[model samples]
Target: MTTAWMNATIYTGEDFAEAILTEDGRIKQVGSAEDILSSSPDRVVDLNGRFVLPGFNDSHLHLRHLGKQLQSLSLSGTKSIQELIVRSRQYLKDHPDRSRVALTGSGWNQDQFSEKRFPTKEELDQISSEIPVALTRVCGHVAVVNSRALEVLGLDASTPNPPGGIVEKKHGELTGLLKETALDYLGPLYPELTSEDLRSQFQAAFSAAVELGVTSAQSNDLSGSNTQALAIWNLLLDMDQKGQIPLRLTQQLALDTFEELDAFFEEAKQPPSDHLSMGPIKLYKDGSLGARTALMQKDYADCPGERGTDALSDESIRKVLSWAQENDRGVIIHVIGDGALERVLNLYEETEDPSRHGLVHCQISTKAQLERIKEIGCYVLAQPIFFDYDLKVLVDRVGDELAATSYAFGTLMRKGVSVSLGTDCPVEGVNPLPNLYCAIARTDLEGKPDGGFHPEHAMTLSEAIRAYTAESAFQEGHADNKGKLAPGYLADFVVLQHDPFQEKPDALLRNRVVMTVIGEKIVYTHHGERSTTR
Candidate 1:
């Protein structure tokens, strides 16, 4: 059936269109309402001049992980160590029958806490001395678990440090702080979710993405663990083939080693679904700035003589990159610090990047490093929302000089580097509006700091929108058809209550998704009712 959404202020990406004609899940035409109406469409829906744009494409996120986070207890904005303890206890008290074997929660930032320090396992023990309690830092790189958890995992001061990870110890004693690979290996040791439950989680995550106007995502759902990662991948492919997944998902496979990757290449089936396809491999090079585990050239401003943890070694990463390039695929590594970027760059210098490898966070770097990135034609996927949290503690973490060049996405764009925007959801929330606001305003959701934080680094309204849409699709090799609202493009667009082009930046924070359309389907309407009259 053919349909025309007429009388709408539609941003057809490059320009505006008075009406859009869609048929068979693709745009047939975009022009003046009179011109489009002349086509004699089967149905007409008058939009009364609402703001319409291409549906958002979140460049990077953890879909399976985010789904799990939705079910797990969240302590995102908890501002005190005492509050962290209290919330964990309260959640257990509130839900007596949730999970008895292990209690897991995330999103606790030590910087925001009143005590201004990492919560020890002893503190987590207050939640339950019987059950293993593990609370991850907001960055997802660091986690603090109770003594019971350590015992259950058979980790102690006597245990040797795992490669690419740390079992953080102080004064020759166990601190229950696991950084990088240690946390990754032990994180899945908790009671596993059933296949049925995993399906539900993915559905929940997809619904949340669609509700926020995200039409597609390059998600890193597969963990480094071999068996579980492959299982989850197969499940996702099955769901995609069955049309259970709503949004387009390009998987960024995370295999722990070359052997695991080889096993995957040999055993994995190529999915036939358009919505589910292979993306670049994801490698972790460092931890996060908030966790004080991000590898940096200089010692942390707050903690003298202590740079963060470097998760990957030159030897392992080189082998993986070689494997990826040889297999005609790309790799996007998680590099958050200047030192980490340098380390990755050195490897790229020795390799031939036919698929153009990328840096996930490319967040902290010098002007020279960014210039080198541009020189290498390496694209970056950045989270502007990270700036919102960094604004308060940046100086304390990286000193003024480094902080100035850090998170400079605008600079990268100016230097001819392709930069795409994302929320890195579950690390932040999966809301594109707030992430867009942070990109445009260079401030937090509340619009803090009079002039905005590093205002020069802020992207314009059009630039931010493009970064979230066209640029995102471009990065995933889908710009030819996805991330645009035009003739022949996918009929995916969103109607917004507020026009970001004309309204204040804050309006984006308060703006609502009036309608979200994917192909011919109206998946979400603001008022919980579909109202497209024929």
Candidate 2:
């Protein structure tokens, strides 16, 4: 069926238009209302002159984790260890169903804690001595579990740290702190989710995403270590077959080793339909700065001789790269530190097809590295929302000189690199407004560091919007058919409460997605009402 959307101020990606004609979930035409509406169309949607743009496309995020975060205890705002304990205890009291699986909570950062230290295993034990409690830091790179969780995982004093990870030890005893690859050990704690549970999670995440104006996402859910990863992929495939996926999703394969890669390909044969498809290979090159595990060239400003560690072994990364190159697959690695970023850049220089592979969180870097990335012409998925947290501690963690050059959003775009924006959801949030605020405001939510932190690096409102849309679609290798509101593109778009061009940067925080339409369907609308007959 063909649908006509008219009487709207629409952003056809590069410019403005008044109407759009869509058929078979794709844009057939975009032009003046009088021109397109002159022709008969089966359906019509009047946007009421609402400012419209292509639906937001997140270049990198974790949809599965976002759903789980919504379902479990959230320790996000926790400012004190005592408060975290109180919240956990409260969650237990409310649910009282601890037998199904291990207790999981995330979104905590010790940097924000009043005590200025990580919550000890003993402290988590207070939440539940019988139940295994595991909490991940906001960066998703570090995690700490209670003593019981350690016992459940069969980890102890004798247990040694695994490759690219540290099962932190303090005076010959496990601190129940795990970093990088060490997080894989917690797999046993994950209760095998049934097909229904998996579907519910996807549906929940999709609903949340569209409400925030996200029409498409490139997410990392298929991990090498997770045995149930294939089942999750299958669930997505099944959802697409039934047109159940509410958002366009491209799964990033998170296989770190050769064995994992081979095993995954052996079982998972074909990609899904339009709503689902497989994208790049994802791997972690290092950890996060908050945990002092983001590998850097120099020692951290606060702790000398304690430079962060690497998450991917050189041998493993090289082998995987070789395999990917041979199989013609794209690879995107998580590298937050300059040292790690430099190594990945060097490795990518040798890539047979650098366009297909790039880096995620290419944050801390030098001017030379930025220039190098531009020359390579590869994708760089950055999170300006990270500045909400990173700005508060960047100078102290990475030192003044390096911190000054970090998160060069505008610079990358000007230098002509394939740059895109995302929140890395469940870490910051999937909300694009806060991310846009941080990008243009160059400050945190509270508006700290007046005049904005490193304001020079801040992206213009137009630049940020395009990064979240066109550039993101480009990142997932679907630039031609997604992102834009141009002819031949997917009929996915959002109607906003404010015309961003006429508003101040802070006004974005107040901006709301008045409506969201995907695949010629009005999936979400303000005031809890959806309409397609308008």
Candidate 3:
């Protein structure tokens, strides 16, 4: 089938074009509308001078968690502890059935609260003492549980803190706060959903992606045991084979042990469909900055003597990387602190190929580290939207010297390191526009800082777009076939109402995705009148 998308303002990275022709799900031609129309294509789409660019590709996120968050109790924008309690009560009142199950909620930040403190077990006990309650902070690295949850998990003041994790306590009493690996204990308490239930959740998540013009994603659904993880992977593959999902998926397997890695490799040896493919193994080198759990070179400015935590020891990381190198598999690690970045980089230099392994959330780094990243030729997966919240607390956590170097996308790009942008959804929402805006503006949604936070480190609009598109595709080994508008490239692109390059940084926050096309099919359209094919 031949389709001509005409009279469009196409940003082809290197240049602009008036039209593009697609045949059999690949771009066949690019030129002026008149030139394309002379061929008398089977179908013609008039974009009416709308903006067209390669579809957004989120390099890293948790798809299943995003879907689960959509249905669960969310304290995402709760401003105070009282508001959080009120919302939790209201959710339980609305969904009386969830009372029996472990009540799970996410997106509460202590920094956002008026008291600037994590909600305690006592605060949550007011809502329910019978039901086990666990609410995750926005960073996903910390969680606060009620007394009931602590009892359910068998955690007490006598219980020792697990390696690479924290169980907060005051004096001799447990405070019901868990950090890093400590949160893993809550896994068994979650009720398992049936395959049919999973299908519904996956469908909801996939629909959400396309609606935001996200044609592709690299997702890590890391919950559950090895058997369950494999099942989830197979289920997603089945969905792709059955055409139940439209967005292209690159699954980042979360293998905790060598045994699980071997098992995953055995199952993933088979070739995947065009829309689905197995990606790198996912690992966490350190925790998140929000909870002060990220391993850092120096102590947090506000809290003396605290350098955060490392999820994996140097020996463990070396072992995992050695295994990956020997097996010819790539790895994507979650590294947030400068200390973690330093350690992981040293390991990458010694045992593995940095190009094949990516650093996720390289949020805190020095100029030296940035130089090393470029020299090592590894990909940096960043969530620019993190600035919306991190900007509020970064200076206090780390001194201004470190804070200035944090989230340095422009510096990374200038240093020749490939940087890709993602929202790390459920941490921040899965909206690409806001992320793009953050990259360009270096400010929160409200547009803080007169110029922008260290505007010197800000990326140009074009650079930001490339990070969200071509650079993201590169991370998944799809740059050759996707992420661009050249001939032979997949016909995956998005149509927008405003030209991103022409609009001011703040204006992009309101920019709407008018239409989304993947593999020559219109998967999402914001309004009927905005899209038409003849």
| Reference-based TM-score of each model | 0.96, 0.96, 0.98
lDDT of 3 by residue, 211-317 (tens): 99999998888445578788887788778879987988888878767777777667754436788888888888888787888899999898999999989888877
**lDDT value, candidate 2, whole model:** 0.86
**Model 3 TM-score?**
0.98
* Candidate 1 segments exceeding 4 Å error: 185-189, 528-530
Write down the lDDT of every candidate, Cα atoms only: 0.85, 0.86, 0.87
Better candidate number, 2 or 3, judged by TM-score: 3
The clash count for each model shown is 0, 0, 0
Runs with alpha carbons beyond 4 Å of true place in candidate 3: 269-271
Instruction: For candidate 1, list the clashing residue pairs, or say none.
Output: none
lDDT per residue for candidate 1 within 402-443, as digits (tens), equals: 887888888788777889999888898888998988888888
Which residue runs does candidate 2 get wrong by more than 4 Å? 528-534
Error of 1 at 446 (Å): 2.4
User: Candidate 1, after superposition: displacement of residue 137 in Å?
Assistant: 1.1
- The predicted structure with the larger lDDT, 1 or 2, is 2
Residues 404-441, candidate 2: write the lDDT tens digits.
88899888888888789988898888999899888888
Please tell me which predicted candidate would have the highest TM-score against the true structure. Answer: 3
RMSD of 2: 1.8
